[model samples]
Target chain A: MPLMFDHVYYTYDASSPLPSKAIEDIHFTLNEPFFCGIIGQTGSGKSTLVQQINALLRPTQGKVIVGEFVVDSSKKKMKEIKSLRKYAGLVFQFAEYQLFEETVLKDVSFGPKNFKENEEVAVEKAKKALKKVGIPEEYFSKSPFELSGGEKRRVAIAGLLAMEPQILILDEPTAGLDPKGAQEILALFYDLYQNGTSILLITHDMNVVLKYCTSVMVLHQGKLLGMYSPLDVFYQKELLSEAEIDAPDLICLVEQMEKKGFSLNRQNIRDIESFVAEIKKMKGEVK
Target chain B: MKALPIGRYTNYDTFLNRLDARFKLLAMILFMVVVFIHFGSRAMDFTFYGLLMVMVLVFMRIAHIRIRQLLRAIKPMWFMMIFLLIINVLVVQTGEAFYIGDFPIHYDALFNTLYTFVRLILMLAFSLILTATTKPMDLTYALEWYLHPLTFIKVPVHIIAMVISLALRFIPTLLEEADRFMKAQASRGVDFENGKLREKVRAIISLIIPLFVSAIQRSTDLADAMEVRGYDPNGKRTRYRIMHFAKRDVLSLFFLLAFFGGMLALSICGIDFYAFIL
Candidate 1:
């Protein structure tokens, strides 16, 4: 069964002097093998919403069902949540810092060990995870902090991938990486998604959202403002503006080109390669 | 071990920050006692007040903390102030009883209570200023030095100091972690707010379990890291961040002595510092 939330209301500290209502009566669902992008301006409650799926948060009102697991306002956290986390690996922002083991291999194996997997199987899982993240097995013996920026980030990611979770949630996985590194990391999401893992991707990058996401959910001021296919979502300039977001440069380029007497169609072509194709076709017609 | 105010320390280069935190600590505790315990006799209280006024001036000069700001800091304690006012005026009726809707107010007891509350407010204000001005680790070091003699009595003073600083250092991190965990739980359909006491506790426990797990995981990681880094907690340690009191610190100590003397005189003379008269 897919994860579902019904009329979830959440607020922080009824007694707090600085009042805040993080999420209010929000409803959403995530189906299997889904590569979903959750984009929001900061404080739009995107982080709060996605965290609820893995039992990291319980809705203040209403109910949530993740597969057979029934999470109501009542269910106290059990080993079930731990099991859920194992099934649904959450790669937190700055997850790299969670690396506490002396060696990268051991650090990667930490979660599986906590899950009570035997040492051998845990190590094997770690190795597989490292490989999946494109890290050489030899680097496993080294300290995680010793790795360069991109490599350290991948190692941190490898730690989550090591658990072999079915539903993988990554928050801004490619942020703060070099351009090539960002491309490679985003491509890694494609690899993970193709392998039948459900992915909930939280990012601010319009380019990342436009490219890999199967469905896009836009969050604004702690509300689920809109959900749509990539092209439909990008064209709504006002919705993007209200959410304080921008469409990718490629989308902007195509739209700008359309106004300049060019009959460039954006459908069946949402990438730079397609843009390139349309440009080359135009060049030929000009000749 | 929690840093008294984890994220609230003000940053400025002033005399208060320069003085030996040990001195401020020892002197403040003594000053606090003078304010609270010496309330009955108005004559000696006058001397302590004179001393506190002098120390306040020296502290303001050195710490770069303003007296006006410190007084304003007491604004948040209005609830406590009201509680004190009521307790002073009622319950402990030492003199004439005034009735308000069948509740009798003891005028003399009320007078003493307000006096006591003012004393506490001033005491709390002084300590708050000290904490708000000094670094937690610095304060820990001050406590450690003050309690160094306890080492001879087998107290493991260093361990206590380490625990305090580490606790202080971790508060901000733990708060952030708790915030993240709460968000994560919320997304999962765990409601932390809007419930009866039992239900609220249940929700909080859901949040706390993860926080506890994370804390333990962090501690485990820290243990391993410390072992790898060759840290022997039981072993005598070298100081990377050394503590040295400057000449200004010595001058501040002298100022502290003057305050200490004045508080002694106030307690002997029987005066209420808050009222500026007996």
Candidate 2:
């Protein structure tokens, strides 16, 4: 399903004495299943922009179009909203803290049951999602809190996945995890994206964006600076610095290599391993 | 929604804001007692209470607190104030009857209702002034100092102070957590606001269950963090913030004492002369 944000704007505590502008004039469109990364510093409205996908937050000004669903400032039907939420599953930061069911299976099935699904179908979906996320069956009957930090996070993501959303929006899914745990979660997301699920990752970690994102959208102070391919975004040092965001590690390595007069092809360097292979290829071509 | 106005201390250099917390607490208690006594006495004119309202507004202005914030602070009590007025007007039926449509209104009840409304409003305004001008840590320390006498009766004054301060610290954190829980559940198709009574209750339960779990986890983590930081419930510790009562605090105390002292003299010396003016 396609996701589109048209001139979207949001204000926190709108009627309060001090209304804060969270996002302003945010315009973007994702018509295909592309791995998109939203990069920004803290309080840059990255989370606010993605929450509009599932109608968790209605835009104060313009509309957010998620395939057939439309979320605007106007009133929305509960059924329409429920369906939209089912279509676009949003995994919030520290989502493991939200787990409350007795067992992992029950917690993972919560989303499906909320959508009015039958018990058998919900359980089947839950089992499939749990298996897809690589959670063992032995741990299914255990309390969600009994699991380790990474396992608990995976269970939380599986809960959203059980609803079978077409577009998966994650806000810092790997936050507060160990390095290995972070990579494990990001690998799962990359696998999911490879299977044609449109993924929108809200992250500040530039390395994550370089390794996983096909396109990058940069936000600074609630304004969209630019949305372009990752390579194009990598070249815009002034824009990146203005947003107070760092370029990806691989991009920095490639820049350093070019500065040293090693003419490595930057466009082909997406990850560390690929960048290394490109350097070796350049060495071979030089020979 | 506007956030709850607790812990909203303005950082302006004002006499009220800079007054020692202990003096502020003592003055507030004494002033409230005098106001309540005046309310019960029925000797002073209603205009005296009006003057008190003006005085509070003046205090707020001197403290650099906006009139908008004062109104917002009292906005939550409008319904309760109106309810008190209605109950007072409907129940007290001893004075001369006045017609309002078909219902007869007692003159004594009307006067009593006005008096009670003003008293309640004054109480709220005084509290707003206290909370707006005082910092949370200062209030906690002032509370500990006020309750220090309870230590003789084994009331664990230090522990009580610690708990109060921790509770104040967690209010904003818990609010943020609850908001996150609500949005997370909302993303899972839980419609909290627009549903049937039963559905809404179910949605609320969904929110509360997660919030409860998270709150417990937060408390446990806080306990661990505090332990790691060498926090002890029974340990002798020095305060980080030392407060000294300065000349401004003395001036505020004098102002409060004079105002309440004059109110007391008026209440006692009225001799029914002010009732004819009302």
Candidate 3:
């Protein structure tokens, strides 16, 4: 069963005379291992909605049902929540700030340690997670703070992966990194999702959303603007405009081509890989 | 990440923001001491309280900010207030030093215990006023300029002032980062508050690790950038905005002195008449 929210709403300070609402009436559900992307402008409450999913934020006036837990209602103890944590791993924007270990190994071991895993076994899991993130074994003993920006990002992810969460949420994971760095991280996530890890990618990078996310959600000024299959969501130009965002360039290009009498679905335009693949498919069909 | 500040003091200026840094600092200190020392002796707390309200009202009017905006700034401190209250009442063990199932009831401990509780609330309020009325940059500069005389003995007042101001300025940013870290951990099912005290403390340590790391990194980068820009920590630098106290500032200083002097005199008289001193 997927995680669902029923009429969720949240504000920064509820008691304030004029509360600054972060999100409202956010309703959505996600089955396991879905590669979903959240797209919105600067203050569109995109982060707020995703935050509620993992119980990072309690809904001000609604229910957040993640698997068996009903947050803001359930009498479940902290131990019960720890098990839930094992299922959902969230990677924050600039997650590098979360790194406070003497060594990369020690840092990644934090999540497993929290679950009361044995020391040796936690190290084993940490090693595997680190390798998966492309960090060499030699870097295991090195302090994580000494690593480069991209390395720090991977290490942060490794820290989360050590928990072995089935559902992973990453917020703007590739922001402030180079294009190559962005692609590498996205590819890692894509592979992970394909291998059965649920992924939530919150980003302003439309290309990342369109290219990798199987589902797309749009938020605007603390409201659930819309959530749709990526293809369907990509064509709503007016909606995107109102949200102070733009559709993927490829999405627009394909739509413009369709408008000029070329019959096309105007989807699969997020990544250059898909860009080439769609053109090839079209040429073959024409022949 | 920039922290959201909520209060009547906006970054932009008015007459209050333009006073001599030293005068403002001295005035604020003297005012706070007088407020704490004499607040209990007043026959009409409401009138004095109303006077404070009017001052805030005047401050808000001049600074072009609304008093209504300070509501959010007052939220998070509630837990602390209640915590201190409970500790005050339960820890003193007076009033027959009795307990109802290991809970102590105290009589004489009431005032001594609750004194700090209310004192902090007012202290924070005034500090908030200080912060709300002044931008982080201006506050730091003011302190540096005000404390410049201390450097004659080789104290490096400018450097000390800079460090403090930098730390103060980044408080909100660090808080925001810490909050995000907690949220991220929470999503993964980490219940920070639901565990044993040791466990909760460990969770907090885990949360602070990244914030401090980022802080060190930012400062290192800042140091490098400053060095590259030909910035000299020890060298005298020209300031773009000249610091000066105008006629309004002189009047404000007089008001501060009069308020403090009257409060001191009132407290002395109160002690002579009642054999008590606040």
The model with the greatest DockQ is: 2
* Position B78, candidate 3: lDDT: 74
Clash totals, every prediction:
40, 0, 5
* Tens-digit lDDT track of model 2 for B1-278: 24464426667778888789899888778767665665323545565676777888898888866777767766777787778768877898796988989998888877776777677667767777888789888999999998989989999999999999999888878888888898888887777777689878878887888888878878999999999999999888897778887887788788888978877776666555555666
How much lDDT does each candidate structure score?
Answer: 0.74, 0.83, 0.74
Q: What share of the true interface contacts does each candidate keep?
A: 0.09, 0.71, 0.58
Q: For all the models shown, what interface RMSD does each have?
A: 7.3, 1.1, 2.1
TM-score of model number 3? 0.77
Please, what are the lDDT tens digits per residue for candidate 2 over residues A89-196?
A: 999998887787889999899899889999999999999999988899999999998999889999999999999988999999989888987888789889989898
Model 3 reproduced share of reference interface contacts: 0.58
User: In candidate 1, what are the lDDT values of residues B204-269, reduced to their tens digit?
Assistant: 764675577578869889879988999877799888777887787788678768866765665566
Clash count, candidate 2: 0
Q: Give the higher-lDDT candidate: 2 or 3.
A: 2
lDDT (tens digit, per residue) of candidate 1 on A162-191: 778888888888888888888888888888
Q: Can you give the TM-score per candidate against the true fold?
A: 0.58, 0.85, 0.77
Stretches of candidate 3 exceeding 4 Å from the true structure = A73-79, A177-181, A252-287, B1-24, B32-129, B150-157, B187-191, B197-201, B234-252, B262-271, B274-278
- Evaluated at residue A123, the lDDT of candidate 2 is 93
lDDT of 3 by residue, A58-93 (tens): 778888877776665343443456666677777888
